[model samples]
Target: MKKVEVIQDFPEVELVGRKLGPFKEGEEVEMRPWEASVLEERDFVRPVRDFSLTGVRKALIREEKSSRLEELPSSFYRTVSREVRRLREGGEVEKAEELEEAIESLVDFRIQKLARMIISSVDLGDIPAEEQVLANFLSQPLTVWEGSIGRVFEKNIDKEVGVHAKKVRRNI
Candidate 1:
């Protein structure tokens, strides 16, 4: 297989009619399978905006989060959800511990929609209007249907669940 050269590259245009610049050499741009994503809401559209490092960082974060889930085996989700259901009505101590774990796992601005409902009583300070909109959006239920770190632990509660990767067998 030919290796895609490490270079700066992006789609030519954005949905908002913005054009991206030509990639410079020596920059690492992802050219792997499923490298690009498409958002189909209307007439053919793609996110092809020219952005600074922040834009790239957001894209990379989104990609990394997606990749993390995709690398897991099929049986991961059902197992975790079952465990969550079992632990859902756990005692105060267990609930507190799970809450701590959830909070610790949250990113800088990980605002769940349920949190917004509770936060609505607080006075809006000097936060920007745009950020407030995002907060509102985030207040929606986060129904993430995918493999997660907690799932791994829940699945192997009785025994050690080592690394998942295994050697591929050839039939030839």
Candidate 2:
């Protein structure tokens, strides 16, 4: 769900077989994200605290300074993607490019951090609901890979130790 503030008056709209709002200017409402996105496309409303470059910068800096994953709004990535698309369509190419670079760097850093957490068997603290799904998905594959690799090493080490033990016994 997203909370949006209406910027223009809008009459009741029937969408997806449901009637939504006769919203007035200055009204704030909570709606399904899809509905809010539809209204947002038409400029009827904007997200209260829409994603901004300054916010992204702060998040990036915070993430860099921490071992734990930085908490972000649940719809953080979706909001950033939408904003970047809007910027490109509006001919704000330079701003869009800068935003894309910053977002990419942040995403890459978070991914690396998440992988480290998973490898270390550490608790995933303060992760957004949206990213929790990603962590869950990655956990299974990583566990499998680690088990497979550990078994291979275990077998080789066991064989080497056995051979060394037999050699020592013979010398004794």
Candidate 3:
């Protein structure tokens, strides 16, 4: 289950023998992913990323970055980024700041993980299944996913080819 904020009013919904809310716009609620998916498909709600743990969140980001073998859904990161900005502008400055920091940390962690994956995939001859996936992800031109973190990944990959790679490699 995860937290999601309603973006539109919805009548009460029953699921698993329990009644959920007649949710209003801007209302936050806990929901199972399957249930949330129904609302999300209609653009009625957005998932709230858990940003409570700096280290754990950063690690998760690293794992996600390294495991990608294909493109993500179009709205995946954009929705989270938009929600963070919304929270920041809606008077939740402290929480927004925390989420923003987590996002930055996640980006950094991802860069480091990609750098390591590049090195291992190129130099180690044969690597793990996940590393192969990372390698495949990197094989695509970053421009294929315009306006996304693919640009950051591309920049990091370029850097990893030189002295900066040495620095990023150490972190991984």
Each prediction's RMSD over C-alphas, in Å, is: 22.6, 11.0, 14.3
lDDT of the structure predicted as candidate 1: 0.37
**Candidate order by lDDT, highest to lowest?**
2, 3, 1
Tens digit per residue, CA lDDT, model 2, 136-159: 989999989887887776666668
Which one wins on TM-score?
2
Residue lDDT tens for model 1, 61-160: 5534651211222332343344445556564457545533542333232333224433453443433344356555654433221235345545554255
State, as a TM-score between 0 and 1, how close model 1 is to the true structure.
Answer: 0.17
- In candidate 3, how many Å is residue 154 off? 29
Off by over 4 Å in 2: 1-50, 163-172
State the lDDT of candidate 3 residue by residue for 1-172, as single tens digits: 8789899999997878978779999999998888899889989898765444453365455556665422223343565577677877899988778777775665565556566656455453444444446657765644344335655765677766966564554322
TM-score of each: 0.17, 0.62, 0.37
Model 3: worst 10 consecutive residues (lDDT sum): 67-76
- Model 2 misses residue 159 by how many Å? 1.7
Candidate 1 scores a C-alpha RMSD against the true structure in Å of: 22.6
Task: Name the candidate, 2 or 3, with the larger lDDT value.
Answer: 2
Of 1 and 2, the candidate ahead on lDDT is 2
Per lDDT, the best of the predicted structures is: 2
